[model samples]
Target: MPVPVGVIEQRDDGPLRRGPRAPAWRRGAAALCAGALPALAFPAPSWWWCAYVALVPWLLLAGSAPTRGRAALDGWLGGAGYMVAVHHWLFGSVHVFIVVLGGLLGLLWAPWGVLVRSLLGGADGPPGAGRSAAALAVVPSAWLLVEIVRSWQGLGGPWGVLGASQWQVVPALRLASVGGVWLVSLAVVAVNVAVALVIVSAASRLTATVALVLGAVATGSVWAWAPLPAESGAAPRIAVVQPGIVSRAPGSPQLRFARSEELTRQVADGRADLVVWGESSVTHSLATHPSLGRRLTALSRTLGADVLVNIDAPDTDARGRHGIFKRSTLVGPGGPTGVTYDKMRLVPLGEYVPARRLLGWVTSVGRAAGQDRVAGRRQVVMTVPRRDGGSLRVGPLICFESAFPDMSRNLANDGAQVLVVQSSTATFQDTWAPAQHASLGALRAAETGRPVVHATLTGVSAVFGPHGERVGRELPTARSASAVYEVPLAQGATLYDRFGDWAVYVAVAVVAAFCAWRGLRRTPGARGGLLRRPLSAPPVPPAHTVHGSPARPGR
Candidate 1:
């Protein structure tokens, strides 16, 4: 008969056996799947509730890993899975390089994985209540640190922030008004940690349950107690024109421009205070193309309102250097109003290759930009004449700029009454990218207490109220149309806008305090504080029973 692992067999010579370990491949695949699960919480599937538990599988795997090295590997694989899943749509444009980028970015999570294992299990079997409680704060703080590091514009920006998954949840939006998406992400990760402790550590079950209850209470408190934005009493009808997909043949710019003009004329109804076009609506710079300027001026005169158009064209600076700029220009009855905001943040590889001299070869791969686009020096808030004889301050964000929360908050701080994001996802019309891009406006609006207008060239143009509520029907990709949204203006700032990433600061402090407490635990005299271990000595191993026993000296 075969002897089972971990069981003692009686024979001429007795020995104990241990079970064979599971293969590394199986654990890695599980980690990858667990990491990808959170992407479902974003757009398309938009399973917001799934985000609350999406990290559990990964956390459990990391926590139970036999060694710290294996746990780190788990974190890397999981982070890669998450990056690929959330950005899978880019595969259409970025091709096979998306996988490589995902792997590189996944490195940011490796330390996080090791941290999880250390706090939850380490060499000991399961964590006690003290460690379980620390995990609630430290784990989320570590996650936030990763988020903040990866949120740099060069690092693909903050496209899939975990808290953004709750854009549709009113209570979550209320929390966003309090602390921006960072706080929401912190709360979400905390809940996941608490739940994992509840499932794995019976001794820490009460502690985990208390954390969960506190998260719920805090969210509820924000919803009930946060101050509301006062209405500015200047609701303006903003018209967004989507040209849909046009031919990519020669002269495509003119084709898109003509189509946008036709749609604007059809939808304006002379009631819109301002007519807005999507990113790259004008292909030719007005300085170089007098006729294009004449046409836009005529359109503005016919609509009886100023027009906001995005220009994607090359321009020559005073220094005689020429570069392509994605600029938002305002046109009144006159040709050009000189109120312009050039796009400051460029898409990493899509708009410009970072460290171009070293990485310029990427342009030969997939669809990376051949020449880097010039960045604007400063953000501009334009004052346009509202049809009611008062001026409205408009802040314009081009394409990827809208993904940044700080930019919108800065605009609100600069006295922008309405926020407009002019974007073109024509290359990704068939994918979920358009919908995902549009969803960001709601989060931005909720964070800054300002109405946001997301105008897209191909599809998925949307408007959100000051509180992140949808203002009108979305213009999806299938239709070539225009829609006017009555966007409400608001006064006063959201706590997130006022305090600016206070949640991140608090998280940093928590992590620092925890680290200090941990460092102090090693000292002989410093172990009697709040997180005192009930029983410090390691558990004694089970006594070995020897049948008949005179052993050899070597044995």
Candidate 2:
């Protein structure tokens, strides 16, 4: 009896004895660091490579324990690290209050770890093909779900979605045409899953390697064979100005007027057919202030080109209700026709704090404090004269509005030949915000199958062609400068622009079906039997054990 009981006990603890249990805090710390690795890789541009391996340690640790609570904790740790690191630039604008914001934002990761652990199972057992398949499909879906949720009105808009990390990767960017940014994100998650499988299971090593190789091959093949929009003609010459004005400065309005004058002078003597200024170039109302309109009209005529100027000012509607219109006004060789495209998507806090009555105190400090800019309700496309005597329609996105895929797609659907983003990044100076903001234009360009010009205060101003390739010149964040480039105006629609994010909705449905199936199959007395018992369950002894002698332990 003693021998039998001892053998059972030994068998129960055998797998546990193979390795020391990692401390909760250590595992949490490792997860945090792992999540942050990819973000630190920013600025260098090569840092995106870290994304492939960054989540491995966190995944491994989550697999080690395999409990729902543990997984949530691990995910929270990792998410906190990733969000804090990537958005550290927020601190530059928000100051020490960022500590609270970072911690609050870290909450986004909790479910990620839980999902990963559930998909992988505990470290002692192998995740079978069923689990592997679910992981391959569900992980990326979960990420997209989270991104969509976080892109709400009050939460931060889509700033650093994983798909944006591959901004410079041409092949991955092509995936945007098929499924918006979700496809690229899925591909990345799939790669990470393959890598995790290879690391964990020796028998599945060859299988994992094949999966990884095939995924790469698939991505590469699509990139090489993807049908791109045909080049219509030589790109129209355009110039963008970065005046680098601080919004709160007493002389900011005057300074912007002077900079606009100078940029117009430069374009007038140059070969530019169109010139663009950053958002709020005229920080006064053009309709109410005739002098401002006169200056823009003179500039457009002097430059002999259509000049797109962003105006941030208050205007009264037909009902005489006073409201602000952050608009893009096109001044051509003719004059200002009062034709304008007001910004649709407004940045929370930065534009107008949600629940302003309750959180009004939040606006008393930091970069966006005391600002009460109103949002526009329409998605209007502004038409300007092309240098070739043809009219070029532009979809104008003000600042944070450019980050939304649907917004840009709608603009293209509205017959916009070019996507123009007028932005102000001076508040986030020298941070990844500008680069991240600039990167989205590439994705938008791909999604819409149209060239996009991002003109910003501070820098990272650039032009992306219909193929999502950077054309013309790009200015770094360190300088107050200008760039002129020819951007081809392509007419047509991309599959994504036409169809929208139907793939994402399909994926969501699939994930829902999977979760429901798993839940039903795991129900008591189901045909497939229950999932493996909890880790704390006692182990059973081998049957062919000798009496009176110590029996061998079960694996």
- List TM-score per model, in order: 0.91, 0.88
Give per-residue CA lDDT, model 1, range 334-403, as digits (tens). Answer: 7788888888999999989999899887777778888788888798899989888998899999989888
Error of 2 at 100 (Å): 3.6
**The 10-residue segment with the lowest total lDDT in model 2:** 6-15
Lowest-sum lDDT 10-residue window in model 1: 8-17
* lDDT tens digits by residue: candidate 2, 1-555: 244422323232112223346777787788778777767445535477666766677777666554667777877777777777877887765666566665666677678777777676653366766567667778768767777777665687776777778777777778888778877777777777778877777754666677788888887877776566676866777789887653467877787678757766876666687788988788778767888778788888877888888888787543455777677888876777667777767887678777778877765567653656666668888766766787677788888988788899898898888898999877777667888888889899897899999998778898999978999768777766777888876766677876898767977886788779867755464334443343353557546535645566762
Write down the lDDT of every candidate, Cα atoms only. 0.87, 0.74
Instruction: Tell me how far the alpha carbon of residue 485 in candidate 1 is from the true structure, in angstroms, after superposition.
Output: 1.1
- What's the CA RMSD of model 1 in angstroms? 5.9
Error of 1 at 467 (Å): 0.2
- Residue 221 displacement (Å), model 2: 3.8
Best by TM-score: 1
Error of 1 at 259 (Å): 0.7
